[model samples]
Every structure is written in C-alpha cells, then in structure tokens.
Target: MSDHGGSGEPTPRILVFSTNNISDPGIDLAGSRHLHYPATVSVLAMPCSSGIKPSWILHALQAGQDGVFIASDGEECAYLPDCAERTAHLVTVTQGLMAEQGLEPQRLKMAAVCSVCAEPFAKYMREFAAALSTLGPRPVTAG
Candidate 1:
C-alpha cells in the first residue's frame, strides 16, 4: 500500500522494503499522524532481508525514487541467525555504488527492528523522511 502526504508538489518517494513482520498498528499510527515532510512511501514486504535482491534497489533508484529504506528483524530473525547482517552488507554495497554514480548514499538506509519495537520503527521512519526532505528529489538519469 502507498502512504502519501504533503503539499501539491511532488513529494520525495521512499520505498520501504520490509523483511519481517511489520507492525500494522505502527504503520497505521505513523501514517495517520503524518510525517514532517511530504512523502510518498510504499511498503513492500519480503520473506526475509536476504530475499531482497540488489536489482530491486537499483530499479527503484533508476526509476527516480528519492530514497530507499530497508527494515529487517535484526538478530531475532526466526529463519536464521543474523539474517539482517546480509541485508546490511547489501545496503552498504548498494550505497557505495549509488555514490559512485553521483547520488547521495545517505538516501539509502538499513534499519533493524524487532516486531515489538514499533516505537523505534516509527521513529526511524520519521527520521528517514526528514532526511529525505533535506536531500530533495534525486536527479533523473538515463536508464
């Protein structure tokens, strides 16, 4: 689903790639309260963080998304130990590539939160949104 709010101007788009059970309550509350900046954020759930292929991130950036946020279960992953670690690595590598291409690596982030850490997740989302606002839209490039 898409959560959008802001002035009429095109808001920075954020793709939230989730690798664990995202707390619906948290999402609802955050969406209802509205973030500090205009944002068009979409949530895409995956079975695990490792399941998120690098190509998906590249596609989002190439498609003009201003930023991407990846959330995983952290060390509490049910399927394996430290599955989020791989996701962290992927984010680092991807961010490096984006930087080399003249993009702001800070636009991409990886957060690890447990199912019960709803407050933290919400906080992270807000901070991320604020950061995106400062960075503004990414420059469009030929794909």
Candidate 2:
C-alpha cells in the first residue's frame, strides 16, 4: 500500500521504537522542551532495546512505513550489559532482511538516545524524515 496523502503530497512517516527505560524519557523531554519534529512520526515504547525483534521492523516496512528508527538506551540499558552491540546486531540483521526484500537498508537507522537527549532526538527525527524523503516511497511491490 502506498500513501501520498489525499492531495498526493509526500508526508513521510516513520515508525520509531524506543526503549522505555532510557530512551522513553528523551521522547517525553522532546515534547516538554517543545522540540519540534514531523507530526507524522509515530512512536512505540519498548521495555528493552534488546527485546526488539527484527521481524517487527520488517512488518512496519512491509506495511509502508517510510523508515524505521530505533532509539537505543546506550549505556543506560538495564537489561543488557552492552546495548550498543545488541542494537547494532539487530540493525544489521534487520537491514539484511530489508535488502532481501529489495529494500534499501538505509531506511533503517539506530542511535543511542538517552533520557536527556531531546535535542538529539529531534535532530535525528528531522534527519530521518529528510532521508526518507530522498528515498521516496517504499518500492512498488508485486501483487
């Protein structure tokens, strides 16, 4: 399914999955701080970044999300000793899945976003939106 708004205007959408322990606060702070980002961006909070499953990312992509951004807990992760590695591994695997489906791996991005990183979170959101704009809509799929 393709979406271009009713007027055919490109309103790139993103599916953001954030770890609740660390990254969730940053998302909240962004709002409290009045950090502005695309209203089209949607967020889902997760208990731990390590608990993230690559299949779900694929499901969002297949469902026509312009891209997927994973907000890692970084050093603040409570469940895993090294959240970065696990997140990287998840990204790598998810990218491979995207590639296998003929999708660009660039559509998936991950970064360490702490609780106080409202600015960084907002910045990255804009960046992701821009990147997705350049990538355009998800590749036309076969029926």
Cα-based lDDT for every prediction: 0.70, 0.87
Tens-place lDDT per residue, model 1, 6-107, is: 444445678888754543334444556653323466777777777777778878888767788887767767776868778788888887778777788888
Backbone clash count for every predicted candidate, in the order shown: 0, 0
Tens digits of per-residue lDDT for model 2, 34-80: 99888778899999888889999988887768789999988889888
Highest lDDT scorer = 2
What TM-score does model 1 achieve against the real structure?
0.78
Per-model root-mean-square deviation over C-alphas? 3.7, 2.5
Model 1: weakest 10-residue lDDT segment is 1-10
Worst ten-residue run, lDDT, model 2?
Answer: 1-10
lDDT computed for candidate 2: 0.87
Clash pairs, candidate 2, are: none
| Candidate 1 runs further than 4 Å off | 1-4, 7-10, 20-39
